[model samples]
Target: MNAITQINPGIRQQILDAFNFRHATKIFDPDRKISDEDFNVILEAARLSPTSFGHEPFRILMIQSPEKRELFREFSWGANGMMNGSSGQLGTASHFGIILAATDELMRAGSDYLQDHYARVKQLPDEVIEIFNGAYGKFQAEDHKITSGREITDWSGKQAYIVLANMMTAGALMGIDSCPIEGFDMARTTQVLAEDFGIDTAKWKPAVMFAFGHRAKDPEFLKTRRTMQDTVSWF
Candidate 1:
């Protein structure tokens, strides 16, 4: 039996219930703001999420101003090419988070960020750190040869999604609603951030976003999902 089955039945049930209670919230109650303490817990969940090579390549951008949220909403509809009209959810959300992936500078070998990440965060010894540096250097070299660093964003974006999942689940456990938003014009997003917010997109690429708040209405209770037999197999 796996470790999941070994978990106490009550705790296992609670875990499953948390997942069941979470959904891509369609509409958020604008008046209902998330408490700073509870939101900090959600951010902590993202910080503690696992990432490839322990790189911790994602940066979180918290959208606080109504004007900025409105700007994003307009960009989503006009230039971002969102078809489902879900991007407007950002306008109604009490909390918004954008995950940005790190650039080549931070991921490079022997960089101060990587050095500190290993020595301080992971507490690796010098020998292990040296090994990691060599391995990561080789891996990054191969990555650049394969895609000229274009794939860096994709690679880091995958890690950000892991963070996104953790944050959403953490929020759900705290009775907060969340939606993972992907349908937005990335070029326009980068442009707006640079022109308006003074964020240099050359250094950090926006990967994904999440909106959090109280649900405006009871989300449609549909538990439809692919059966385990269809999606998984036993050897």
Candidate 2:
């Protein structure tokens, strides 16, 4: 099945209920960790999130090893602002970091990447984000205007958040807790992974990361939620 297709409504309430139960965990139990299978379930959840087109839009880097996770913990400088750190005795790193990156390597000059771009665009039907991003790509090539690398990274990075939300929600349904981390030095991270992983820096840019593990205690506060009508109303 296409990853982006919305699930049927027979169990929509159950799914939304799962969402209601979800929250941004301030800490996870470092002594305990998620099973490999459950981790894959969350990865699949991310894979199933919607994208601008059929392009899938990003790659998943699951860093579970202690060394790697520690490296991220040390280098992750800017991701905490989004942590919503209302309160905490001590932060946990159970889920460690799951890196969601846009794979623009396929986005470069002639290769299967360009072909996949066209193919996905053809499948977009009436999607607005697709329409806009597709046109933007064309404009980039023809107008020959150079958008800063950070600009392109930021633009694509937004999509990763969508994937992050879905994964957290789905993980919550499985009785897992998550911390959506935006407090990290992404460029520096690219350097660390590049040296060891043999990954080319340009092909992938870090969009976001999440730490998942069992919640150690109650969150300090119930996160505020906006009603549907308040969040959306007819003009």
| Best-fitting candidate, scored by TM-score | 1
C-alpha local distance difference test of each model = 0.81, 0.65
Least accurate 10 contiguous residues by lDDT in model 2: 81-90
Q: Candidate 2: TM-score?
A: 0.71
Off by over 4 Å in 2: 1-13, 77-91, 103-105, 108-112, 116-148, 227-229
Clashing pairs in 1: 80-185
User: Candidate 2's residue-wise lDDT over 104-173, tens digit each?
Assistant: 4554323366555655754434465456456657754566442556554554576788888888887888
Provide the lDDT at 33 for model 2: 74
lDDT of 1 at 201: 78
Q: Provide the TM-score for each candidate, comma-separated.
A: 0.86, 0.71
- For 57-160, candidate 1 gives per-residue lDDT tens digits of 98999988877876777656521225545545766788886899877666667778899999998999999999999888778777544234557667788899
Clashing pairs in 2: 78-183, 78-184, 79-182, 79-183, 79-184, 80-183, 95-212
Model 1: lowest-lDDT 10 consecutive positions: 78-87
